[model samples]
Target: MTFTPHILESALLLLATFLIGCAIGFVLRRFLAKPSKLVSTKAEAPVGAKPQKKVAAASPTKAAPAKKGARPAARKQTPPQSDSAESQAIDAGTEEDDLKKISGIGPKLENELKASGILTYAQIAGWSARTIDEMDAKLNARGRIKRDDWVRQAKALNKAKASA
Candidate 1:
């Protein structure tokens, strides 16, 4: 039962299990292989890609028509009409074309009183019809300063601007 040194010790234990499975597949392909530019779980983004346009803002230019006694002066104090002109450009001394001398102000309620800081006619003649019905119940304005009939229409336009 010695057949040529037991087939040379079973061919040296099958060449030491194929050289220990090629030295454990060359040390797991030199530490778990991977990285020949392969991080692609699919998001490289150029196959017909078309998503990025946003740029459009440039319109304001038209000015030149306000003079007649260059008006604006009648504000004898009482100012703070609920803080609006972007809530802090609070000069409120009056401008934004003095909200077109209020026969019921326009241009979208003068951009909703310059977006709520009531830009001027001396802060809508220092408001107070319960602060123009709490800014016409928070900007649904439309009642055109009917903030409960704006303090008797701002005391009849300040008694017709103090008898003109």
Candidate 2:
């Protein structure tokens, strides 16, 4: 209550504390920045004799802390039916058809089918009993394939294409 005489001293002390805090924060930030990758010069060796190993980029000594309220990296997406249909037609490299021709297969359903590696009628027509279950699960169709007889329609379409 009687610091009027020492007002200047109190102000100086406060200023020093703030300056020290700022300096410490700056140093910490500098130390935390990612280090630049090091590249070795290749001119010392013969031009075309043999290539030399690159200086391995150093890993961070400390893992970067996750930011507050930030989400983790998204999970990697797998190709549809990769496990079951690897031999089916994920990369059949054949001409795709308008799956929308099927009664229940709308544009959205067609896209879902395409995303699940069902491009041609032949692929759908060839679905095995096990494959039907897997595809049904993937599409969340609630057994719509069985209900709508998509296999029969696909077989018909496949036959028509073969005839043409």
- Could you tell me the TM-score of candidate 1? 0.24
Clashing pairs in 2: none
Query: Judged by lDDT, which candidate is best?
Result: 2
Once fitted onto the true fold, the runs of candidate 2 whose alpha carbons sit more than 4 angstroms away are 1-83, 90-93
The lDDT values for all models are 0.60, 0.78
lDDT of 2 at 35: 88
Residues 1-164, model 2: lDDT tens digits: 88876998989999999999999999998999788888986534311124567897778986798899999989998775433532465454688999999878888889988876678898888877767777777777889888888889999998999999
In the range 1-164, model 1's lDDT, one tens digit per residue, is 65999899999999999999999999999999985875669544321234689987765666566789898669788865433223234554534544544666558766866656555444455654455655675667667577345435445665666577
109 Cα displacement, candidate 1 (Å): 60
Candidate 1 lDDT at 47 equals 19
My TM-score estimates for the predictions, one after another, are 0.24, 0.47
